[model samples]
Target chain A: MRTVDPAKREAKRLQILAAAARCFARKGFGQTRTADICAEAGMSPGNLFYYFGSKQDIFAAVVEQDGVDTEALFAGLSAAEPWDALTRFFDLVVDLAADADYARLALEISAQAHRDERIAALVAANDRSVRSGLADLVARATGAGRIDPGLDPTTTATWLATLVDGLFNRVAVDAGFAPERERESLHLILARLLRHEAQPES
Target chain B: MRTVDPAKREAKRLQILAAAARCFARKGFGQTRTADICAEAGMSPGNLFYYFGSKQDIFAAVVEQDGVDTEALFAGLSAAEPWDALTRFFDLVVDLAADADYARLALEISAQAHRDERIAALVAANDRSVRSGLADLVARATGAGRIDPGLDPTTTATWLATLVDGLFNRVAVDAGFAPERERESLHLILARLLRHEAQPES
Candidate 1:
């Protein structure tokens, strides 16, 4: 057998994850099969197995990939104003929610996370990362005295993260609920929470 | 057959709903069978069918029963001291979260509400009722000058309701996340949001 190229292996892994995400989004985790993923990826069962050993592995990889992509989207933005950063975060989340397939996948993962320990742990880890990142941003803003020092950054971060999750679920269920309205409401809420006195410098 | 008594029929309907709630709590909506509900109720499947045409019907009844119970729980409460009413609301929610079986049932319904239109409508109706009740409370509170009059009662009520939902989900996922701790934080957050000047009445 020829040696597998590293770049080719990485590409195949991503391909399998994308296909698996689509399958999971459509049929749900319980109904989806490895064969279905293989067909979706246009790859043989052996090739699919070469990248992910099992269905759970494929799921974990998909979640990991989502986290990586989200992190990259928000990376290297230290110079931006606090309000701008918050607005960017809300816009990114709304864009994610706009995709029906992605939203379904997220709901499936959340439902499964309730019953499965491994999935719950994965979700918890991902949630912690996001919360910590947000807390860091809050802390920086606090240092600049943009937010009240009395408020706990970590708790506020957790609350904001929870709001994001709730907003995503709402968007998934209610088609009439406009993301623009939500984004505006969130900006106002964040401004109030942060005690921002000046007009947001867009 | 003997003439059916209206009161007795209503009682039986309530009984059936209770049994269905238990079954849904144990096995979830998707996993629960009509037979499972019959077994839970110690009745024949035919009897269960007479009471509810299908599993979905029984699920609907369970939700309707919950709505009635919640309404009764909040009945006769004037919106006088909306902040106090709001605190009481959170306390009641915390108590409900303490009931493990009910908490599971709520989460199951919430998850199913995402995929099923019938369930979604039922949940939305329930949400609307609660929000209106909360708005009444908020209006009274605003009238008493307890909370900031600048904030719209409906919007504040909606936000409060969403906060409870987020807190309940967190409590379900992490047993260590104490409802009491979050309740304290909620009180603080609400005080700030409402711009309460005096110390919150315990």
Candidate 2:
């Protein structure tokens, strides 16, 4: 019997997903063939299937990986103050947006979601994860009297999530938009939206 | 000498673009064939080519049409108070978002822009027009003392544009998000972001 190292197998799966992201971003979801992904990942076609069943499966994995990343992001912020946690999350968003391929891949995934039910559901789950995360923070902040009570937590979180989604779209759509410079204004907008006093941008 | 009726030509062009939009939204830009657009438009393939040289050309026209629509939208809003104009513009956005095909087509166009330079330039132009319209309103509002003075008009406009971009994306990505119901929260978010009093959701 051949023994497969579980950790090694998992790492290889991540490696394929990373390569697939690049292919999808450059050629779009429909234009990219499975062979292109295998080529990008520097693996044989047989090796690629060992990790993902097909192209659709790989795409779903990418979408799920995004969900996992969001969960990890929120998990790390669990101990921080609600408002500060949000601040850190937005900061991380800017950091992620700094990578053009990641931002482009996000845009591609959104387009795919529009066409595929499975992707749409996956993206929806990721969005729900984000909104729920924001909602939790908003509830905590409102309870602690850190922000305004004029809006409910879920709605506020939804709109905040909208801003985050829009931030990524802006990065993909506007070449001239520099995410680093917008960080200050993003802070200002979030502060105002939450009705909390904002620390002046540095 | 052969001559064409300009008005009729324009009408047919619009007809073809609308059909193309439907096909692109349904199948995505890459997967959509010219014949599909022709069938959707209810015209012969030759007639379709008379209006647009290639699939790429028709896509560009669709993008340009979006810019024209934006310009028309802002021009129509010219007489209103700056803040009211901004608010009304967002309301119009929500109204448009109610159209699923239009929203999906927008996602397709944004995805196309990421892959094609021609589309990118056109999309950027549309984005700039939106930002400028919002900036013009923001500048006037600040001048009229209608909002906070902490942020510049351009930056405020950019973020506001980001929110608009994000709103469309939310519609595309989140099935449960109803644009009609979001009006009140959107207004509230805008009010908070701009430091204006929010009108209660009706």
Top lDDT hit: 2
Which consecutive 10 residues in model 2 chain A have the weakest lDDT in total? Answer: A193-202
Best by TM-score: 2
Pairs that collide, model 2: none
**In angstroms, how far off is B105's CA in candidate 1?**
2.9
Tens digit of per-residue lDDT, candidate 1, span B48-107? 777788898889778777778778766845533556777788788878867767766776
Docking class for candidate 2: acceptable
TM-score of 2: 0.96
RMSD (Å) per prediction: 4.8, 3.7
Best-matching candidate per DockQ:
2
Model 1, A2-103: lDDT tens digits are 699999889888989999999988777767899999999999998888787899989888877877876666575456786567668778777787777787
Query: In model 2, what lDDT does residue A171 have?
Result: 86
With candidate 2 superimposed using the best TM-score fit, by how many Å does residue A192's alpha carbon deviate from the native? 0.5
Give the residue spans of candidate 1 off by over 4 A. A33-47, A70-83, A196-202, B3-12, B74-76, B172-175, B196-202
